[model samples]
Target: MESTAIGLWGIPLAILAGAIRVSTPFIFVSLGETITERSGRINLGLEGTLVFGAMTAYAIAVVTGSPWLGVAGAMAAGASFGLIHGFICRWPKVNDIAIGIAMMQFGLGLAFFLGKPYIQPAAPHLPSIPFGFWSGLPQIQAALDINVLFLIGAALTFALRWVLANTRIGLTLRVVGDSTDAARAMGIDPHRVRLVATAVGGAFAAVGGAYLSLYYPGAWNEGISSGQGLMAVALVIFARWNPVGCFLAALLFGGAGALGPALQSVGVTSGYYLFYAAPYALTLVIMIATSSPNRPVPGMPGALSLTK
Candidate 1:
């Protein structure tokens, strides 16, 4: 029913297409993580938030026949998770990282259990723009058929970068993240700002999950997310918690992920599985390159637990 292309030239094109497709989830998750971390809180549980959001988005889409509505539901669910994490961490002597790990497992279990029945059902997919229509080459047309969310993610990246650099809320977040004491001294509630930031972070991650289930791969299942959430944590580190950097880092991961399929498309199967490891390898490389025992990566938020 589908025709595969046959040409050495297609390899690069294939990689380009795959990069856009695969990087979308990364873009969203890292952007979300950027927000949370910038507020001086880390949310490793985003993997769970991402998974549960996938389940929620898929389930609602199937029931309501409107993927947009499903996305809204996913955002609400993700925000609830973020709120739970933020609130618990505010308690005296609480461990945020451990809570995030526990939440990740809980989200996975809950999603797997509730998503069982709905896996077999089909849902409406999000729409994409045909940017490649002008190209006579089918591969180019396919490569340019980008989802609207990717565009939105790009816009958010720029908007976030600007907001963080210029806005009053941005100033508050920076103060809260750099020194909780300073925030309190200025009559700003660090806890309140962090809580809101985490909620926003969760909402963004949920949209990424929505893209996963309702767009790419275009289905609901137990295996919809394969650690994209976790990878995003490393991505945030790699990006130095900068929104623009997160967007570029996401695209890099996406390109790495697409490398495998691009090679396969060119009939290189000798190390197909190895190609799948590209993103992880790239992640390790980035972390190693940006870090050392000598000093914290430049731009790391001072109040971050990792930095401490």
Candidate 2:
């Protein structure tokens, strides 16, 4: 009876653990999206970039027997993709959203074409910290074995929040996002600012892909990413464009994601497929709750297209 009671209590703990593990990618992707959207651009192609990054990271790690190299390669690929988006969007009357979709398809196609051989190959895994070493419980130890990316994602969130609120570069980013004309008037090149921001955002998104391939699932496969990349765009909107909010919202999404597995573990299996929609449902709810006909949220960039 006592063990049964303990098991019931463990359900929530397991969910929390799953949330922590699963939320890392969401944290990175959402934060990256926040940065890009804040700079008055949106990159829907991050989905493709993510898939390509995952494949590249896995292929590199397999060849070199070094997971760190995989991360570096992923960042390079992401940055290159971002550069392409930035350069192309600079053209007169270019539709950034359309370009984003095209980029996404291009990325996915490229990843599938290049990653064909790596599908079955084994690769090195990313390092993890053993925070549960002192807990003396198997569940605790498993929970504590956190990937380093989680910490990095958390730190980046706080750092980004501070930079946007306190830094001169952040001020300029805001100006460009709000109004390109205003940016030109202030002698701050909106195009240049947006280009840099998009590239950085791509790099971050690539890291999220790296985490998926080399750490969480840790493999090279065509299905490595479902819709995490696309869902992140909605997450940025749901977070109201705040990096810190993005973090917390990611955790919530993660928890929603873990619901199905958690429920199945203890014999609750009524609506398995429905559980998969938890994150999307939350996203829709939040969007409805916060959206307005006029005036964006407090932290949202003025030039962002999502709000309009």
Question: What would the per-residue lDDT of candidate 2 be over residues 6-96, giving only the tens digit for each residue?
Answer: 5876678668888988888899888888888888999998999899889889999999999999999999999899989998999999889
lDDT of 1 by residue, 1-308 (tens): 01255367687777778888998989999999999999999999999999999999999999999999999999999999999999999998888899999989998999899999999999999899999999887888898999988999999999999999999988999999999999999999999999998988888888899999999988998889989999999999999999999998999899999998888766678888888888898899998898878877789888998844
Candidate 1 residue-pair clash tally: 0
**Window of ten residues with lowest summed lDDT in model 2:** 1-10
The residue pairs in collision within model 1 are none
- Residue pairs clashing in model 2 are none
TM-score of 2: 0.95
After superposition, candidate 1 runs with Cα above 4 Å error: 1-6
The residue-level lDDT of candidate 1 at 104 comes to 94
Total clashes in model 2, counting residue pairs 3 or more apart in sequence or in different chains: 0
